[model samples]
Target: MDRVHLNPPPAADVAERADAHSVAPLLNCLLREAAAPHGGSRDADGRAPDDGRRVYRLRGSGRLLRVLGERRPAEPEMYVSDAWQRIGHAELVKLVADELRRHTGLSNHELPAEIIDSRNALAALLTARARATAPDDLYLRSEQSLLTGHPFHPAPKARGGGPVATWLPYAPEAHARFPLTLLGLREDTVVEEGDTSALDALGEAPPGYRLLPAHPWQLDLVGRELADAFADGRLVRLGTTGFDTWPTAAIRTLYAPERDLFVKFSLDVRITNDIRRLWRHDLLKLRRTDTATAAALAAIDGPAAWLGDRGYRTADFAFEELAVLVRDGLRGRVLPGATPLLAAGLVEGFEGSPLPGAQDPAAWWEAYLAQVVPPALAAFADHGVVLEAHLQNTLVAVGTDGMPVQALFRDAEGVKLLPDVSRAAGWERLVYCLVVNHLVEIAGALAAHHPTLNPWPAVRRELARHDLPEIPALLSSPTLPGKTNLLLRWTGADGADARYLPLPNPLAG
Candidate 1:
């Protein structure tokens, strides 16, 4: 057999592929959150078009735009000179920047640049992915397969505007894996909370110091700032771990197969809506949030589980900067023989997704709803825990038949307590995260695969099984809160401060 040769595609081909991957998410944000429906374009019955292709008028520019494809917009065209002109990724960025400038009465120089960087990053990922061999484990393959992440963020692939060479070696998209950098912090400077026993097993530290593992990429970014501490012997480089860890979709989090543990680090990099560093405020409240979620999951009556963020370890001198979260891995929580795959990967698609090979699409979808919906709702109603059950945070385990048997949710940092936030606010957030962000994307992907199947009725039925007072309104509400990622970045809002615009609710019918 001949060996396969991996070579970079021509620059033009890279540009075209990058545009294909990046434009859809930006257009979805623009059309859903920014554009107004063209006048008199509603169907005869006054219903918005159900077809993926639709026409809209940009609210700011007042320009007509036509796009084909939904969930992930494609074939975007702008009406110019009384004719439709296809817009490339570069032109689309300009169009979006100009529209935002007019719509908000403000200009953002950084967002547009990030948009460019996002497209460039996608191009690099595509080139690297083509040459890379996917991991044999289906779960690992799914974890690393998100080429077009978020599907609604303008800059889903941006890496803090860094060069490709600087970040690609650790990129999950590139199927890269490397050992974690380890350090020995002086014992007096070690700060920790909860059970971080997993860290103790990574490597041994000297009598005067404790072991602290760090993401090498993060160390590279902040090394200069830490020269003083190292010089003073407060921090000692202990080299790297003996075993390698795979970076999950959330780039900062790595999965150590040997230990069956997840280590989340604080990296000063802007991924989608925020610089994804583990903030000091979040770290301070970590134990309380994780405890609430763990108890809620314990009360849940089924296999649906919560991967507890057991605890964290960091140096007191650089607490948030060097903090690392220790999370329970899949070995114990997941059912035996059932493989867990990232829910986002199921939507974005990968080499061996159960969605395409699903024998009974309707039954498969129902089984999925059964596994995913109840736990999230129960956590809210019975317990005050509001889970951020969006795609990336959720994992579905399927048995031999490829039918979903369990749902596991992670990320305590994103959870919200009921009494801390008003009931109404918590309900709205739960709805947005579980319904708009999670179920909608999965439903769309299922519908796309089996066009004849209608996914919302099953979802409505699954949600109706719950006794929450909000269910009736959720099913009948005319609109859902669609996150305004484009405007959020353009207006320089806090990433955690989510804003929304009304999007037509398919479940309303």
Candidate 2:
């Protein structure tokens, strides 16, 4: 697999802190500076500079933080900070409390303070939408995922407000202000990248301060109005949507900050177009699109309506950015008896290798194929939606006994349905994304999980057992499976070899 280099956070050195409380003064000073104008300036290279040297880069998030004073500024990169070395937990809490007070005028007790301290603090706070009452608006709901390991999800609000716009994290530098959303407060003030509505709301700066909001794209998702009514707080504000490129432009929350959910919203119009595209494939397209890859989820979502009724929770549909917000799953608090199958470590590993275990390769392989794959198929079958059951997209949580129990699928963009009931009708993209890109991951995982479960034979058997069309003939046919063999190159086997087999394309029927 190719390695993708992630841009690191701004540098902070551990040596500079007396305790976590030290971060408070730095945050206060930075927020104060962020609120002022001209207190900071762009360097010769158009970067924000401090004391004749570039202290930070102007990010899409609008606000700036100090890069390590030790590194040369011209490099234009994010590195670790020196202050973190000396900072203690007590001071960090104090700093966060002070900053929250400055922004929302509320204390730690009134808000989700513990969340504000987590790596995904900004995302969790923002994706939390105020609930709405109107039936039409109820289709939308705020979604959240973890940014890092921690317990935090914004407290559900009691009153109604507008839909949630976006939530993310924020930090500021001396004389420059950044939005609380950057720090992870739910914000609707800024509508686009580099927009500074949070600063505008703060009004005029005092003395040498300049205020800035986090970058617009940093936000997770725009909450449906229904969510606002349920969560009330002064910090949550509304912003204008000016983007005209697409009908109902929405923010899609992708994985970030080591933890976080990812979500994608489709415009009402776009959903219509997509549904049409999907229906063109086959009359059974819709049914195939909604079913789960693992038989386990199918059982739970199907005959197991009891699970959701009993305590196992499920949401109807997830918005893209909201997924990015709460992808961490209530700040890493997995409910009792429920396991998070798609954990950070598992996900990162699954991306490169399909197999689940580093040790006892043979046993791990059998366990993955037998235990993991069926639930996915079940989930999709029960839902009547062909889910993208691929490894990167699905999270199959197992119980203490190592048996699969729960299935969590992320990335709404990959979910598809038939026109009969889908908001997104005719959308082949969902089918391609979920069934093709996603389920392929499952196949890879099976291959990686065990050598005995050959990709070709396993795919064929699984497809046949699920009652999907075609098996032996497609493998012998010269065109389709042959193409896949060439494209995927199953473990270096020749496309024409007996080793290469085919699975029924539910869409083909």
Candidate 3:
């Protein structure tokens, strides 16, 4: 609707905006994973459609579809009853299920509900945004500014189809901030790795216990499971934190600017592709992955930094359920006089976002490419560390003039160690996350705002400078792997298992 630069529109417009927001990503997934360009590739003008209105064949049903916009496609219509009829979120979900079932020879009873739930969630977020005051701090506003997340997922905002009142108070999109639920875990049952001393500063514990700060929403979701721990001596309820922590774009992660710390908590709710929980497998390997990523970012010669996971602490009885990861705050790593903003927010746009109105588009884009691309490439090439350099995992810090000065990457849970997987597999994963998922979205957003800018040439030049052998082949690959989230959900594949189909490589142009 807008550049994500303003609050939710007037009372009259929330549903329409919400519908548009919800429809864009669903259409994006269908077009990328299930639909093919129908008729001819070009419009009647005999040129590529700069306006994102294009028709597609639903591959499975061979039905014709039209949608507006490219980066975040919207305004879907199905050619039905001898006419193109516009469809709402519900109709779109039904059509998507039918097409996916026909194409994949599978059925997902749960996914359609998720698609609708995502739409409902957006309506709630938009309503909440209309009432709530956005944070004055640029970074906080950026962190809370994703109206539509995961530009190419079917149901990115679904929250287990839960009631809005239950989750809205904790949603990042609503500019939510609240005190953490403080609990004391008995010293005997406090399973911890690395230094989690930062948690101790948030609250106090009695003689026999260790302090643990938890997301209040997560506590609400798992109170029944944790009753035994609280009833017995294993866990004791201390009061809530005296200060509030703002939820970052990753809903479970809360940033306490007072202490300059971020604590990532476990949520059993499924958001996007996976249940956003601190599973035992990922938690156990957290240290090793965080270590490698930290070392790689340290060696990379630039302002680029890694927000390392300091450690984790939880009750041994409910380890995965209650675990909390303490992470390094931005005070130290972020360059002085620079404001760190979520890279995804840059694409989604915020009130003060520079991407939309960059005065020197070429210089702005080149500086962005220079800061973001080098560290990710270096991490893969020099250290065998493939950081999940996707948009959500990255933060680009800008100086006073709103020019990018540094890039910081996080989420060690998503990192892939090279030798653990084959070199080929590792490279593929790196390319998908870094190039397809991260840079392409950013470039699209930038180009949409500044049409004259050809974002890919700068990307190509940046890659050509990299020393890695894979860079040469990457530059010439005709297509890049575009993840098939829609098909993955329809086929009931493991959330961790990524399936890919090719999308034309923009850089190869």
TM-scores, all candidates, are: 0.97, 0.33, 0.96
Q: What's the candidate order when arranged by decreasing TM-score?
A: 1, 3, 2
Q: For candidate 2, give the lDDT of residue 321.
A: 25
Best by lDDT: 1
Clashes counted in candidate 1 amount to: 0
- Distance from true position, residue 482, model 1, in Å? 0.9
Error of 3 at 316 (Å): 1.0
Q: Which residue ranges in model 3 land beyond 4 Å of their true spot?
A: 1-12, 41-52
lDDT of 3 at 331: 97
Tens digits of per-residue lDDT for model 1, 271-334:
9999888998998899999999999999999999999999999998898889999999999899
lDDT of each: 0.90, 0.30, 0.88
Q: What TM value does model 2 have?
A: 0.33
Q: What is the lDDT ranking, best to worst?
A: 1, 3, 2
Clashing pairs in 1: none
Q: Residue 67 lDDT in model 2?
A: 26
**Which digits, one per residue and each the tens of the lDDT, describe model 3 over residues 1-509?**
12333454675588788788888888989998888887555543345556667888889999888888667777787878766688988888899999988998888899999988998899888888777888888999999999899888899899988899999999999888999999988999989999898988887799999998888889889999988888887888898999999999999999999999999999989888888999889989989999999999999899999999989998888888899999999998999999999999998998999897788988998899899999988988888998889999999999888899999999999999989877888889989998999999898888889888888988999999988999888889899998988888888888889888899999899
- Per-prediction tally of clashes: 0, 140, 0
